[model samples]
Target chain A: MTDLRKSDRLIKLGLLMIAFSAISALFVITLFIFEQGGPIMFKYGLKSFIFGQDWYPSEKIFGLWPMIVGSLMVTLGALIIGVPLGLATAIFLAEFSSRRLARILKPVIELLAGIPSVVYGFLGLMFLIPFIRENLGGPGLSVLAASIILGIMILPTVISISLDSIRAVPDCYREGSIALGATRWQTVRMVVLPAARSGILAAIILGMGRAIGETMAVIMVAGNAAEIPSSILQPVRTLTSNIALEMGYAAGEHRQALFATGVILFVIIMVLNTIANLTASRQGKR
Target chain B: MKETAIEVRNLNHFYNRHQSLKNINLEVYRHEILAIIGPAKSGKSTFLTCLNRMSDLIPGARVEGQILIDGQDIYRPEVDVVALRRKFGMVFATPIPLPMSIYENVVYGVRLAGKNNRPELDRLVEDSLEKAGLWNEVKDRLRISALKLSGGQQQRLCLARILALKPEYILLDEPTSGLDPISTMKIEDSLRRLKQNYTIILVTNNTKQAARVADRTAFFLMGELVEVAETEIIFTRPTDKRTEAYLEGKFG
Candidate 1:
């Protein structure tokens, strides 16, 4: 009995230690970001710093609207390009393609996802940016470049998630529809897509979060312009790029302003993540 | 001779390298309920799916058979499989309604066949629901999700969905296996009424159910047909000793 009690206590201690490490990791990360950027933000007033658009270190006029708008525009552009393509690929992979074709295609999609974002940025800078500059008459490093690169970067996430959701729908639903004399495409359009709608929506939201929070790839391609871009061809600066670019050199009010931008970007991502979580939970219940 | 609703000639099927159905031959008359009775893995479901070409959905499944519906060879390359399936529908042992409203589920078949007018759709939905013996229970909640219905109601909704297509032959593979006694009785009653307008081919493990609703019964064992006779004869005075042994509950 004493030996059993000692073993039980050891198991409990191990579990507690695991749980503490997980929570401590999360807490430490959050606290470090706050500790580094918090005091300056409080001193400079978050609202003025965030809403203000001008960022001139010499003149001391700093606002983050251009950065926020740039992030929103680039994310929107990525979504516009990625979501439909991802959904189409997912539908083909899950519903239309033969098992042999699906087998061949699935790993290719996974490989696309596995490639590092920096490599994608490099490829975009080397081939896509120059091609667009020659063909579309745009700056080599433009919002369009960032958007297209990020869109390709997030495609695998959307396709894989949407495919899993579509596949999760029981074969019975497909058989039921087919047995009713509905064509395969008709069944997919009318029954399968509707059943997987929430999951597909969650995929899109996750893709959006990935696009919004991406820093390294966007910084390499986006022109780092402080002004809000009026066209995809023009240079722009996103919230993430702004933080990464200025965190090293910024001090006092300028550093606080960049942190304020981070806070705003963090809020947008939180909302998106919340929506994805809620949708997945609701789909689970169904 | 009376018109045959379905004809199977020298039917054989394979699942990958394994043979599933062997040299099956059968005929189903119009407006009659034909029951296929067998123990598990007897290829009864395979035979039923062959009628509507559903067995082809599985990978590595191949069929060497000729299935004729109303004198038309269904396996001919010129024949439209989708249209053929619409004319000959099926229901599984477990009820599976599309994830849609009750009204939508009922008219799904009709809509797929391109009948889109609102008034016509509403009429079909009402008529099909009534025919499936579910209109009274679900009339007030036609817009409610079909998943919200009980298992029995979902089964009936699936029935209504198939009925709305106006198929000449309806195939049911153990349609009441998952229902309670009352629900099973309700389904049996519904099938009896439905036989007036549609021919039904049902596969069941229950001897009593075969005796209850079948006009004729076909007994199968180990992927081979053992006996086919009128329901009364098969239950009370089976010609084959295997059939007799099976009816007597001696090793199905």
Candidate 2:
């Protein structure tokens, strides 16, 4: 018995050491990013660095306003395209579809998340961008193209999580409503949706994080022009695209500005992730 | 002779080729509390769900039966299922309160029918809760979450919810099984008062409960009803040996 207890303690210590690696790595990365990027914000004045318009790296002038706006616009557009589509598909799978049909469709939708982001970017560039250029009349690569690709990319995350949450609602609630003369649609609208509200909101929030944090696909489709876009059809540069495009030979303050952009991206993703967690926790309270 | 409110003829229910209810023929009278007593897997609950067509929601659930409510066959495709469902208010073995305020839980069915009048909704909520014997306890905290209520209170709230629907028949499938004795007595009191307005069918495992409250008693064994008679006759001089054995605690 003593030997078994000793082995258990050793195993616990071993697992604890392994778990600390990820946390420590995250701590180191956050520290390094702040150390490299934090000085530039203070040196250039935080206000101008965040709100300035000019992006001449050689001149040491870095205004991130356009990229911030670009990220927000693209993220908002992606939500507009993704939310209703993903939620509708989730509802259909969880409540309406037969088991065989849901089984086939669920795996296929989840498979969308596995395809490389680069492949999605290439598809958008090859088809969606060209279509927009010819018909909608703008540079093929624009915020609209990026938003559409990102929306499709995040569907699996949104759909699967939303589906799980909807299914999590107790069958008894559905029974109660249906027994009260509620149509299937009415039961879904009034009872199931309300019961699953927090979880659905969390799923959407996580999807939002995915849309905003997406770097490679946005770089490929959003024609990287570092200027505040007048309209969605116009080319715009996101914070992520700004860093990836200019980081190759960027020396001195240019590299620091890129790191600063990463810090902002990290902060935004952290906030969204925290909000998603809080919403999911609320779901457990019931 | 009592008027029959519901008639079941040649009733057979199946779940994926496994018959759950077999050749059920029963008549439920107007304004009477009919208790169905049986052991587990005896089709008591299935019979209640079948009456309201709630069994139809289950996949691979097939029914070869004629259930007539008010002399009209409820199985016809054109017979609006929503309206048919509203005609039989059902309470399950476990109380299920929709995740909402107590007042909202009561009026959920009413709201679905597009009745949004605030004062009328308030009145309906009060009347339903009063009828369910839950008004005094919950009247002060109508806006609180129904989930916060005790199990017994929640069950009564479920009863109030169905009361608000103004259903013709009250179908209870072991409603007080999860509740305490006091709650069970209170629910029985509500039922006695409610029988003046609505027909009720109760499925229970407790034989004494049936003896105490049911005007008529039925014994179902292995998907088939062995006998149904007046509560006194069924308990004291049961014609079926199975019913006698079940009532005597010899075999369940």
Candidate 3:
């Protein structure tokens, strides 16, 4: 009995050590980014660093307004393309479709997430870019292409999480609504959707995070023009692309500016995650 | 001398291959509280769901008998199922508050029926809550979450939600099973008053609850209804041995 208890204690300590290591890694990365990036923001003034549109690192002019706009534009475009399609698919899979049909379609939809980001970029490069250039009158690689690619990339996250939350609604609510003469659509609209609203909102925030943070696909499809695009058809550079594209050649304060870009990205994601947690916990308490 | 409000003839219900109700024949008079008492899984709840056609929501659930409400067969195809469901209000064994404010919970059904006028809704909310014996307790904070209320209050909120629909029949399936005695008594008082305006079909696990509020009582055993008669007769001189055994604590 003593031996068993000692082994159990050792196992618990090992698991705690492993968990602490993972958390400490996060803390270390956060500290390192802030350490490398903080001095630039302090020296340059937060307003100029954040709202400056010109981003020539060699001349020591580092305004990130274009990248910030680019990130917001692409993420918003992705949401426009994704949310309706994802929510409709989730509702169909969770509430409307036959069990056998949902069974057949669910894995295929999930398989979308398993596809490497490069493949999606490749597909966008091959088909979507050419189609956009031919029809919408821009260079093949533009914000539209990246937006479409990122939109498709985030569908699995949105659909699966929304589906889970919608399914989590108690059947009793549906029964009560139906008993009150609510049509299936009414029941879904009034009760199930409201009950699942926080979760769906959290899913949307998560998908937004995924879209904003995606680098490879955006780098591949986005033309990487550092200037703010006047139109949706024009090329733009997102923060992730700016970091990944210039980190190789950047030196001195230029490199520190890239780290600062990462710090901004980190803060944006942290804010989004915090909001998602708040929405989810509020619903849980309800 | 009494009008038949609902008639069941040779009713048989099945979930997949499992038979739940076997040849149930009964007549419910208008403006009467009819209590159905049975042990667990004795088809009591199944009978109540069938009345409101809530059984239709369950996959693989089949009904092979005719239920005529107001002399119209309800099982026929091309029936307006949504309209049919609105004819009866149902309260389940557990209280479900729809995760909204108490005012919204009461007004949910009326809003679904497209009655959204504000003053009209307010009146409906107050009237239904009054009828359910919950207005005085909940009137001060109609905007509070129904979940914040006690279990008993939530059950009464469920009743108020039903009453807001203005349904012709109230079908309760062990609604007070989880409530304390005082809450149960409040509901019983509401039922006694409600019977004047609505036909109430109560399926209960508590025989004493039926004895307290039911005008007529039906005893069911297995899937079969053993006896149905006036409440005093069923309680004082039960004709069926199973009902006597059940009531005497011989067995469930």
Candidate 4:
């Protein structure tokens, strides 16, 4: 018994060490990014660094307002294109389809997520860009192309999570609604959807995170033009694209500015994740 | 003896070929409480669900029967299931207060039926809650979450939810199996009052409950109903040997 207790204690300590190591790594990375980027923001002045549009690194004009707008536009476009299709697919998989069909479709949809980001970028560049150019009358590589690619990339994430949440609703709610004379569609709309509301909202926020943080695919189709786009057809640049494009040759304050962009992306993701957590916890309490 | 509210003839039910309810026939009279008592897996719940066609929700559950409510076949292909369900409301063993307020829970059925006038809904909510014996306790907090109520109150709220539909027939499956004795008696009292206006069919594990509130009682065993008779006759002078054995607690 003593031997067993000693071994258990050693194993418990080892696991605790591993857990804290992972958490401390996150803290270290956060500290490093802020440290590297903080001085640059101060030297450039916070307003000029964030809101100035000109991004000519050679001239030391580091205004990133256009990239901020670009990120927002692309993310919004992805949601507009992805949410309806993803939610419909989730509802079909969870509520309407046979178990055999859902079993077949769910894994195939999840397989889309395993395809490398570069592969998606290549496909978007080769096919979608040209298609958009021919049909919509802008440069082939434009905000529209990036948004479409990112939207497709996030479909698996949105559908799988939403499907899980929708399926999590208890059968009692459905039975109760149906027993009260509500049709199947009416039951789904009035009862199941409300019960699964928080989870679905969390899924959408997660998808938004994916859309905002995606780098390679957005870069390939987004033209990487440092300008605020006036329409969906125009070329644009995102913060992720900005870092990826300039990080290789950047030195001195230029490198620090790239780190500052990473800091901003990190903060955005943290905020999204916090909201997702709160939504999930509120659902748990209910 | 009285006008039949429901008649089941030559009924059988199967879940993926494992028969759960064998050939059974029963009749429920208007404005009468018919209690079905049996051990677990005796098909009492299945028989109750069949009356209102709630069994249709279970995938792979196949039923072949003629269940006539007011002499109209409920399982007919062209029957309007929604309309049929509106006429026959069901409450399950577990209390499922929709994740909404108390007032909303009572008016949920009425709203689905397209009655949206606020004053009309207010009156219906009060009447239903009172019929369920919950209005006096929850009248001031009708806007609060139904889930925040005690287990007994939640169960009564579920009863109110069904009452709001003003159904002609009310089917309850072990409605008090999860409740304390006081709560059970409160529901029994409500059922006694409710019987004046609606036909009630109760499936329960408690034999004494059947004795206390049921006008007639049916005994079931292993997917077959052994006998059904007046509650007094079934308790004191059961005719079937199996029903006698069950009432004596000799074997399940």
Local lDDT at B217 for model 3: 99
lDDT of 3 by residue, B1-252 (tens): 999999999999999999999999999999999999989999999999889889988999999889999889999997899999888999988999898899999998888888889999999999999999999998999998898999999999999998999999999999999999999999999999999999999999999999999999999888899999999999999998888999987877
Taking the tens digit of each residue's C-alpha lDDT, what string does model 3 give over A38-104?
A: 9999899999999998999989999999998999899999999998899999999999999899999
Best by TM-score: 2
Candidate 4 CAPRI assessment class: medium
Compute DockQ for each candidate against the true complex. Answer: 0.76, 0.78, 0.71, 0.68
Model 2 C-alpha lDDT per residue in residues B1-252, reported as the tens digit of each score = 999999999999999989999999999999999999999999999998888889889999998979998899888788888888888899988999999899999999999988999999999999999999999999899999999999999999999999999999999999899999999999999999999999999999999899989999999999998999999999999998889999989877
- Candidate 3 wrong stretches, greater than 4 Å: A1-9, A43-45, A279-286
- Predicted complex 1: DockQ: 0.76
Q: Write the per-residue lDDT of candidate 1 for residues A76-187, one digit (tens) a residue.
A: 9999889989999999999888889999999899899888888987898899889989999879789889989989988999999999999999999999999998888999
Q: Runs in model 1 with CA error above 4 Å?
A: A32-47, A276-286
Q: Candidate 1 residues B1-252, lDDT tens each?
A: 767878889899999999999999999999899999988999999998888889878889999978877778788889888988888878899899999889988888888778899998899899998998999999998998899999999998999899899888889999999999998998999999999999999999998999999999999988899889899999989889988988888887
How far is B99's C-alpha from truth in model 3 (Å)? Answer: 0.4
- Prediction 1 global C-alpha lDDT: 0.88
Q: Which TM-score values does chain B get in all models?
A: 0.97, 0.99, 0.99, 0.98
Please write out the lDDT profile of model 2 over residues A155-212, one tens digit for every residue: 9999999999999999999999999999999999999998899879878998998999
Best by lDDT: 3
Candidate 2 regions exceeding 4 Å error are A275-286
Candidate 4, A109-181: lDDT as tens digits: 9999999999999999899998999998889888899989989988999999999999999989999889888
